[model samples]
Target: MAIRDVRAYIEEHGLVETADEESEKSIWRKSGFEGVRSFGEMEQILSRFIREHRDARRLNRAQVGIMVGLHETIFARYERAFSKLHVTRLIHLCEILDCSPIEVVHAAAPHLFGDNRKEADDKMKLILCILDMPALTAASLLAMIEGLVGERERSGD
Candidate 1:
């Protein structure tokens, strides 16, 4: 189905307001099953993508770090998925790997970015301009996002 149709269905059913719980229940009742991922699941997907891309390119952590102006230890942490990635650094990593942000993001969040290819491509470019920061900042940003999501849920707006 088109994204518009899916959005209309979700709105009509009050699914987005309910998060995955209500949506999954309704989908499972209608169909046989529904799959929902936790935040860690998405993280793992993204981590695996980075690791696989590095392996495919035959680039070691040290090599990637040198290319990206980071130390080998820091880059190793990123490769191991132990570091919280800033979008700007992720963009640089993509450039070094000769890959697209849209590709990586979509691989990590297919349910979100896959259906809308053009939109994903546009977002990839726009996010490149986001400021670089450490993992702690990324964690804080995630917390803020969760807070906003909670507020939206509570306000039902």
Candidate 2:
């Protein structure tokens, strides 16, 4: 479904406002996301991702609900955007679906990966490649990356 449709559903269900009543801000306006333009889009992306992952695994809402210890209707609310998906609940759902929580986050905010789609896609591909590597190889790469990052930090890059 389109984000607009999800947004409409959320509005219709009276789920659009937080208790704080602050206006929604673009993700980029927050610290560490200075250039992002996506605003208030994560909820839609998250709902879609959850539903897609569940479908891909051939699991119904009831099955996933049992795995996550939530009632089927409660879990369905999340996928239907009638309720917000908290981080802890997202982690539990991801575990049950055998999907990476980071993947869902990436889908919600690709700008976190890079400044543009191509750059983001490249970084995401690199990340997936690292995940597919042998454990020792992955560890070696991690160490190398750490060393490079440390050096860059020391050099004020």
Candidate 3:
């Protein structure tokens, strides 16, 4: 099962939220997902990250350009809060979580994009693999997360 499925079961069943990060870590391992919500929760988490992180605030493309050393308008295209991000920018974003592209997709949408649950179990598995990536330095990763979520939202599949 995919981690997405387990997460749904958790939410639908009202599984008591646990304080132990370790216990939280155990969710994907135990549930074995089957499918994910039609309206993905991945974006919600990404939005949370941007809101939680001071540096990740919404900036016009120009501000992001200043931050990432790119053409200001290049970043602006995504300012509407509904555009897919460029991959290069995504790499910059991962550096913040000390995370990887793989980690971001897994955490945010494992069932939709994970390497087949046979290979990927949970978001944590991916996070653990990239745990040593690097602490937040650039706002790129947040943007990438936003982009993916935005893309999913647009499709409305």
Candidate 4:
């Protein structure tokens, strides 16, 4: 169904406040993201991440488009931020590029992953290191982390 139809259905069912009752600006302010990057800026960042991943894989836009079952021009629109990249489409594109959605999100908004930019970068580096490790070594690291988490939970941390 079209977005408008879905919206209308939701409003009709009182699932959410109508736009008339809650403006977009109010919603944004209420969401506590007023000073964060704008949607357009985030979109551009995500688009750049997509392009970089494609380049790193040495694959052209057309090749990625074919793999993701989108027309090259349509995919280009996403890269140009002319069209919004839906989450499902992002996941599909990440799959085609042999990358994870979390990686793309972290690239776009590292601040979401940690208390500060440096912390986020360090976490990303550690995650990349783990990803590059041998399977057994990674498994051992996971076990250690799980044990630490269990201990923390036991202490009500």
Candidate 5:
């Protein structure tokens, strides 16, 4: 199904309130599951994506909830089940993981997977742009990111 059809399904399922145009629009625009084969497929896609991001920011239950727009309890309750994750939340989580939505879906589907996440993450973190703190000296290099007096500001932030 295309985005329009996905939106229609959500509307039919009463998942989107008529008053919340933004939520409705968000589902269509950002949902990674659009045209995906099944909820099982959605689950596989997000699980691997989360695994890839498990080290960064160390997403706690609450953080995962925020990323997926589900309640903390909901996230905790469903953390193990791939079928419960929403497509919209999956896409948003990919953004947080600094990966594309396509990557998440591909990662989930073993049959279609091409990239090795561990390798990619290692390489991605090596990129200068990902180094929040550029340590110019041995002393600075010893400093952990949280130890930096000035939280290195992101370029656009």
Candidate 6:
């Protein structure tokens, strides 16, 4: 069975939470996400991306549906988050939208895609730009900093 079906079974059987107000939910909650909640969130993000790209491209629902081999009603439901889209359909959507899967992923959950490292690297570049230093000078400065750090480590400081 699909993960959604499993989630539905668990919920229907009261495995996640009790009907009583005093009872808390399951032990499976993490970062505000349960299995079914994750699916819903993904659907929302994907639907928004598809709609935005389709509108920006000035493509109508019928056009996208024909391009992706889906009926217009189904495509409309997909955009409205009334249906789940498979991975293959998502790839087809990306191709029709003229966007890459990486772009969609970065848009959907940027936090999961090395965004902190990218932001830090960008800040470092900004700092270098503000300093107005040449590339060679920046390289030399980084080397000096590394050397100093190594020396301090070796001296147990």
Model number with the top TM-score: 4
TM-score for every candidate vs. truth?
A: 0.52, 0.70, 0.34, 0.71, 0.38, 0.52
Question: Alpha carbon lDDT of residue 119, candidate 2?
Answer: 86
Candidate 2 TM-score, true structure as reference: 0.70
Q: How many residue pairs clash in all the candidates, one count each?
A: 0, 0, 7, 0, 0, 0
- Checking candidate 2 for backbone clashes, the offending pairs are none
**Which ten contiguous residues of candidate 4 have the minimum total lDDT?**
26-35
**Residue range 33-148, candidate 4, lDDT tens digits:** 22455567778889998999899999998999999888999899999988889999999988888887888888777866676778888988888788789999999999999999
The runs of at least 3 residues in candidate 1 whose Cα sits more than 4 Å from the true structure, single-residue gaps closed, are 1-34, 113-157
The sequence of per-residue lDDT tens digits that candidate 2 reaches over residues 79-127 is 9877889999999988888878878878877767886778877988888
Model 3 misplaced regions, further than 4 Å: 1-64, 70-80, 96-98, 112-130, 133-157
User: Order of candidates by TM-score, top first?
Assistant: 4, 2, 6, 1, 5, 3
Q: How many backbone clashes does candidate 1 have?
A: 0
Q: What are the C-alpha RMSDs, in order, of all predicted structures?
A: 13.4, 11.1, 17.0, 7.8, 14.1, 11.3
Winner on lDDT (1 vs 3): 1
* Candidate 6 per-residue C-alpha lDDT over 31-106 given as tens digits, one digit per residue, 9 for 90 to 100: 2122223546767888999999999999999999999888899899999988987888889998899876666665
User: Per-residue alpha-carbon lDDT of model 1 for 1-157, expressed as tens digits?
Assistant: 5565776776664443323432444341111112455445556677788889999999888888899898999887776667867799889888888777777766666445423556655665545533345678768987998999999999998
Better of 2 and 6 by lDDT: 2
Clashing residue pairs in candidate 4 are none
Ordered list by lDDT, greatest first: 4, 2, 6, 1, 5, 3
lDDT of 1 at 43: 64
lDDT of 2 at 97: 87
Clashing pairs in 5: none
Whole-structure CA lDDT of model 6: 0.71
Please give the lDDT score for candidate 2: 0.77
